[model samples]
Target: MDLIRDDDENNSISANPPEGYVEPGWPALYSALHQDPQYLYQPYAIWRFTLYWTLLFYGFVFLVTGLLLLLNFTKRHPRLALLSFALWILSSLLLGLISSTIVAYALAALYNAAFLRMSTWVPPLWGAVQVLLLIFSAAANVPFFTG
Candidate 1:
């Protein structure tokens, strides 16, 4: 089943206002009045994207561990197994949160851009900001786990 419906014909925001309706000067008001049609699908999208990425990352970790085990590297270096387990735990907790937050904010920014009629550069700039946030979070988290 499709999580996002392509019913834009029914969901499109009206350009013309109803009789006696006064347009507000505030962009926030416009956003409130004419929300993105895809707003309803955002939760599902975020959940799916987060789950997909988290599982992919988890799989990568597992694959590496399996390869190490196959090579007898884990037996030679017992600490490797412990490190792998710690990485799994970190992926379970931190990675899930990060992916979900990234998906949520990215979708929100996209919807906001569409509804607000923001400049073309705005979405990419917002995406860059999200990437920076992810990098900062990873940098901050690494020392705690490593040291």
Candidate 2:
């Protein structure tokens, strides 16, 4: 994101760096991480492992959600099915990440509506559950991890 913004060819010639543009300060964070003796001596292999595992987990979730939509399964309820698909589409827009977290939360609102419409007490579908799970994952990463 910063690279795109920093490039004069991409941004307006008059564009100035965004707020808090201190070059040396950013590297200090990584340097601080290394200052910790535990992390300083650690091999890059462990970092690679964390990266791969994170990718695998997220990729599996995305693939499964998409496959559920691709197959005829979620179509059992047309409205909710399309709603679920729309949720995924919206995520692609990065409105959830850029605009606001509320965008991601709207999924739960839709889920509640679906539940209200459906007469059953059981969990209607995984749309709501998946959304919540994603929210949890995002929060956990944003707070402590480098996602």
lDDT (tens digit, per residue) of candidate 2 on 1-147: 343223335432112223553222111223334553111111222223223333334445655766678566465777777777767665544432332233223433443333321111112122244446676777787846764
lDDT of 2 at 142: 82
Task: Provide the clash count, candidate 1.
Answer: 0
Steric clash pairs (candidate 1): none
Q: Write the per-residue lDDT of candidate 1 for residues 1-147, one digit (tens) a residue.
A: 633332335442222222453322211112434763122223334344444444454455545655555466567677876676666556545655565566656665565444422322333343345445655666787867656
Candidate 2 wrongly placed segments (more than 4 Å): 1-43, 72-147
* CA lDDT scores, all candidates in order: 0.46, 0.38
Where is model 2 poorest over a 10-residue stretch in terms of lDDT?
37-46
In order of appearance, the predictions have TM-scores of 0.37, 0.24
Best by lDDT: 1
TM-score for predicted model 2 compared with the true structure: 0.24
| Alpha-carbon RMSD, candidate 2 | 19.6
